[model samples]
Target chain A: MASKTSSDITVIQPPRGWSFPNLREVWDARAILLNFVQRNFNVTYRQTIGGPIYAVYTPFMTMIGYTLLLGVLFGAQEGLSVPYPLFSFCALLVWTLFTNVTQNATTSLTQNTNLIQKIYIPRLVFPLIETCMQLLTFAIAFVVLLLMMVVYAQPFLWQIVWVVFYVAVALVFSLGFGLLFAGFQARFRDMSYLVQTINRLLFFVTPVVYDSTLLPAPFNTLYIYNPMALVIEGMRWAMLNVGEQPALIPTLSAVGVSVALLLVALLVFQRLEPTVADVL
Target chain B: MKPENAIEIDNVSKVYYVAESVTEARGRARVLRNLTSPLRRLRATLAGQSAFGAEIPVKALDEVSFEVPQGKILGLIGKNGSGKSTLLKILSRITAPSSGQVRIRGKVGSLLEVGTGFHQELTGRENIYMNGAVLGMTRADINRHFDDIIGFAGVGAFLDTPVKRYSSGMRVRLAFAVSAFFEPEVLLIDEVLSVGDAEFQKRSLGKISDVSRDGRTVVIVSHNLSAILSHCDLVAWLNKGKLASVGNTAQITSEYLLSSTFESDTLAGEKRFRDFVPSDKYPFELLAMRTYDDQQHVRSSFLNGMPVVVELEFKLGAPKWCTTTPSVRCIGCVGLSRPICSIRDRITSTRSCKFTAKMC
Candidate 1:
């Protein structure tokens, strides 16, 4: 008979502060991530009648709210010969992505908190899924927003090409900000309330309900400090060819801010990742 | 190749900081000011609050390490807060440790709760794929095992019914079947068998045993001490988030059970069959009875048909009562509160009386 070895009884531990994920090791669990995202999308719709229909229709309702509140109620001028519905629809397209992604990301760690504490997957995956799911919603809403713009704006503006570029930037910005807030919310908890408040405040600060022409030169420069302002403005310019072209300097500054925030968010999230299970 | 160990958790430790108070202010001034408020701090401290609700770091697991060899079943025994679930979660990759690393050799499937990933709106069939997907099974793999999984769950009648409509027992059975069939290299099961009826429990256990025999590793966390002891070949005892002992199942379980001081109950009863002659009016006999351990040792101390000796002391009243035999009755095995027993032999004495009997 052969003798048993100690490895037969004892588990081996990994090195201290191991940060880099062996991609292949993580990749093997790709089915889990895909299933989770699919489940979330399916669940979100299954709870309602014509679920994907609602996802598509809700953006139009939001556009009506913006049309009434910003276009008719507050009388924010719609320039570049774009109809209020077309312009507001464009803003809604981008803003919904930002808001939905942020909300999903912020609550990702907290709501599925039990799952977070019980299993170990890359923590980043939860928020990333939220972003991707909302992107699907964004894509559905974008088609309607584009059709309205072409139908009402009197001509097909190839300027709609810029929508893709703006969407990419918006996504990166959302991920960056979403990560920062999600990490903070995991710890402080007060960040949950703060995130909602910030979202409301940001609606006014960004051109979501209005045009960038409402702002003067230096303030437009100051607007870049709020990265979403450039994103919203760029989105409008690209989708409706509305208002002033966002200056290159401010655009570059916005890009720079987004990159910095993304790096910082990753670092902060990683540094705090180890504590998340404990805190939660 | 000889199968590698399924899981290797080395020196895993997790530390949690409990906030004393909900209020935490940013910067140095808040800290200094809070220090001066002794009364507030005292009140908060008494209430288990920290300045910023003071952070008291608790070590959930401290330098704990263990392994489950391939195809072997390991039982994790621990008191409440012993970090057994925490250890399982780390191995399952649900939570990260504060320090240390865990490397699992193969695909890990976990059933931390009976319905850990079930969606209420999705029907039984839909959730099968959803849960399968969550457990790292590709759709095609799930398709391959689809009939086996559904057949094992025995929910064919309600296959299209939303899971919310299924009874809790049905849900547990289906969820457990899904987990069992996923066929990962390592399976982490946490107290899932406690959910269902005895027949279901037996089914689930049989499934788990089959998984182990198929050259996969299993780590089980259960409060059913006897179940764990009987099923596990290797047992690890955890106390207060630390490893109390680890080795052979018998040695560890006995040590774990005996180390605790069990309280004894004074009022206990036993059952007996006796023939007693009635004095004047009536004559009857006692049929059956039982004695209960007051210290909650009923299961721990007694097994079916085990002989137990009992001693009884009493004061005799009168000779007239001597004709009646003392008899005892045992009752309340299923749902009755107290066991009823009769004494067979009657005693007549002025002083203290002692009688010894063996309980059947």
Candidate 2:
């Protein structure tokens, strides 16, 4: 043998009817998580003519379609003087990141049926890796949005750096929702579709296409407390310096709510992990 | 748990929910059932009954209890669905037991599949590290054994080629090589030896022996009796969902093979063969068994997919009324269940119907 093995004892017992997340184990197994991340990245563009080049242009192309549909068909309406294309692109970029992250998270466990059923890595690794992939895609889309800012002759706001914070909030909340549903999707095959439909409906509720500040009072009220609506509007404020500057009270509370939701979702994920393996 | 015991499983049981009511419903009906399940469950709970028994609880493993000593190989033998796989799954933490506990003394690595996480787009070298990492090997451990893994797999020439381009044999060899080098303190192997070519099996058995010699404990679940008999110091037999017996390998395994009601379902033989305890109901026992090649030379291993003749020597003294099954046409001795028959394409038969038998 080339090396001496570590002698760590493990005790396996019946689940105690509640599951508390094993954060230490998840941290210790980070290398396996990296390998999973590598596998996903390596396979993402296989057999495609453009390869990972699509990562750069796919979001750009989708932006084009949105620009025509939303920017051209529906002109800029009281958007505080920013070009329609730039405003919508900023919102669309954040929205896409949320949907992509949530969609992948919702199906992560069910997609790797072979790995989950045969091997014993922390199941949390799947959704976590997916979140990483979505974040990487979000970075690429942010770069594209920056290039658009130059084309529209938009001012380079130092506040643009805060876009990262909005991305974090979107990701954290989407991950929480995705993880909670991914666990369910393992047992109920209908859950993936349900999550996708919910995502579609969520887009309209979120201030992705239209300005929440310009909406009537009852609807503009969404910007105050809803984490997702706060995220989209916050991204717009950070990118275009639009709408009431997303007050510190709302921003801090939004972050607090999203983080709390993630913690609860993680707990639910741990509780459902064992039963999910059986169904998958 | 004793200091010498590497694993102590106390009354472990794994339960599964078989959703019959949901499964029986057609497409739209299935969706409807899924939608109304919570309400139905509520109604049933109010009535102190079940929600149409949709999920029938199955004890795949029922109160199975056993111990494996350090530096030894313990074999788990059981019929199909007798909970062998379920027990291994519990030990490996792939699934949790419904009740009871299992305490293992050291780090555990399970080889349930040969190449569980191998990506087709990845090269052989990349897969080596990835598979090793997935199986709980640290990056340093993989680096130390990298050269050995390559040499063992004999795929140095194609190390950089994507696994998809490799021949099927090459893939199997590469997959086996990574698993063979996995050095956990306690190893749980479940019939993974039945994979790959014959020479690969030899290397697998050798690796297993190497692991045992290193003072690590191994718990193997396999239907290959000869492999188990040659390697295991102790054996546990599971009948139905419970542990039937555990003791000396030679004794428990032979009793397990002869006593198990495995092929009895198809056989018209006497009901005595179905006895959970062969010694309790009948005096019949398997004396010795061996495998022979076409040249009639005794051998411990056979080539992959090749026809091999297995000879079984059994004691026979059943009552005249306990007639043997007609399907079994023995060439020698008064009647028993053994038949001097032929079974080709015996890819993975736990119990073959055709074998030569002699009454001693």
Candidate 3:
């Protein structure tokens, strides 16, 4: 039998204003994070016959639709040296990653109410796990994109390494929004529907299906400020070398804004963490 | 600062702000009242009273404080809505108290419900990892105890099957096995032991005792007084979010039973004659009858496998030349009562008789 000894003491009290999450506790629970990611990855396509193929199929079908509607029917320029299918597919990959991460992370807290009420783990792990799962899907989709690029005979520039940087920006950007919305969604259920509306409207404003140059001056300038647009366009610029070179100042500003939003989201999420179980 | 104290709670209180629905103002008089309500509200506000239509603040716990020494099992008992679960949630850090503080030593693992983080789509093997992780066990720890957990749960055959296909009992078994074997220094278990069959419950209780005897602290929140009396070294009783009493298991439980209306009248030996009317033909009266457990504690309810000792304390008006036998009847809800068993006593010439029946 082990002797009675107090190795450490955990002091808990009501949070006031903002509380910093105990990152060490989260680090200690890395196994739980891995399990959450694995469960999500498996359950996403558990009963489906296609299994992981659906990850590639979704963007493939969307790319075909955009090529027919925007490329041929609407006479929209591909805005890149690569074919319209490859061009729009690259943008679709980044857009899908952002949207999936944001929507899933936003609802992760509400979806895991049973776990939240019954156990004690780092609450931030849910959002982090959701983001990581979406990242895994993005990785799978990236493989499909690589295959498509090879078939299209698109030039693989040395700048392809920069795709990693753009993808990181996209992940941070969506995760920031996810944390913000998840905090509010835990309090007001209407925020879920509101996020859906905002995301739908954001799609039209983002340069996902069409290049930002297609829009007139003010709208194009305003659209450039959207962090996701910078990510999608930057990925295209790095991979295809077809789109205009991203302005250094604007891209750096987007990164700064994403980092700031992430900090704010973290603070808000930590403040609301203690009360989330009660509200749920 | 004492190394022996595992948990210390000081002046903890929780207040909930609940919204109140405003009824619709109807008809002429209601409209007039609604129109003038602002004036009344202003007057009340000037008089230092809360305005009507404000959110109601409910106090779930009020300045409750207690401490538990290491390596002891403490049982918390209370009626419904007495804030026992809230206190447990606070201790588990699921939610923070509205005021005051809680300090806990060592790694705290809480099992508020069975299969808390189990995903329905995941197989039993996968769920074991998920639930174990949720309970604060690392992947390596779970891997090391993998065979032991599967053996304990007896779900090895269904380990590869999805949890949704498993029966509820199997799920609970797997859940309890993982939690019990995780072996946290301080384990907070809610009423999860009440889920399974009699044998499972017995084994679960046995496992809890094993954990207790292993020199770890366990806090159990349960309504089953017998389980508490048998398992807990110390008991705390809560009434309406307030600490009613805390002491030795038997003392607090007995006091709680005595103060509450849950006690049986026969146990107190009060108004035994009123249980049944005396027949003029028989010239005999029933004095008192009650059931008790093996510990000699009077219990009005019993689990399926427990031994029951029924005692009949009665007065015989006339010591006639007839043998007196005490029989027990099984009554069904369909209003059918049949004599299932009886205990025959030798003929006695005494006015008072006491018959005891032991049924295992």
**Among these predicted structures, which one has the highest DockQ?**
2
Chain A TM-score for candidate 1 is 0.85
On the 0 to 100 scale, the lDDT of residue A141 in model 3 is 94
Q: iRMS for model 1?
A: 8.1
- How well does candidate 3 reproduce the true complex, by DockQ? 0.41
Residue A56, candidate 1: alpha-carbon lDDT: 65
Q: Residue A118 CA error for candidate 3 (Å)?
A: 0.6
Cα error, candidate 1, residue A270 (Å) = 1.9
Could you tell me which 10 consecutive residues in candidate 1 chain B have the lowest summed lDDT?
A: B331-340
What local lDDT does model 1 show for residue B267? 29
How does candidate 3 fare on TM-score?
A: 0.84
Model 2 - which docking category? Answer: acceptable
lDDT of 1 at B217: 78
Tell me, by TM-score, which candidate is best: 3
DockQ of each: 0.29, 0.46, 0.41
Error of 2 at B165 (Å): 1.6
lDDT of 2 by residue, B126-218 (tens): 899899989999888889888989998899999999999999989988998999989888999999999887887988898999999998889
| Clash count in backbone of candidate 1 | 39
lDDT by residue (B22-138, candidate 1, tens digit) is: 444554556787767856754543232243544678888998877667788899998889999888877776555667877666566787876566888889998898777666667
Q: List the candidates ranked by lDDT, beginning with the highest.
A: 3, 2, 1
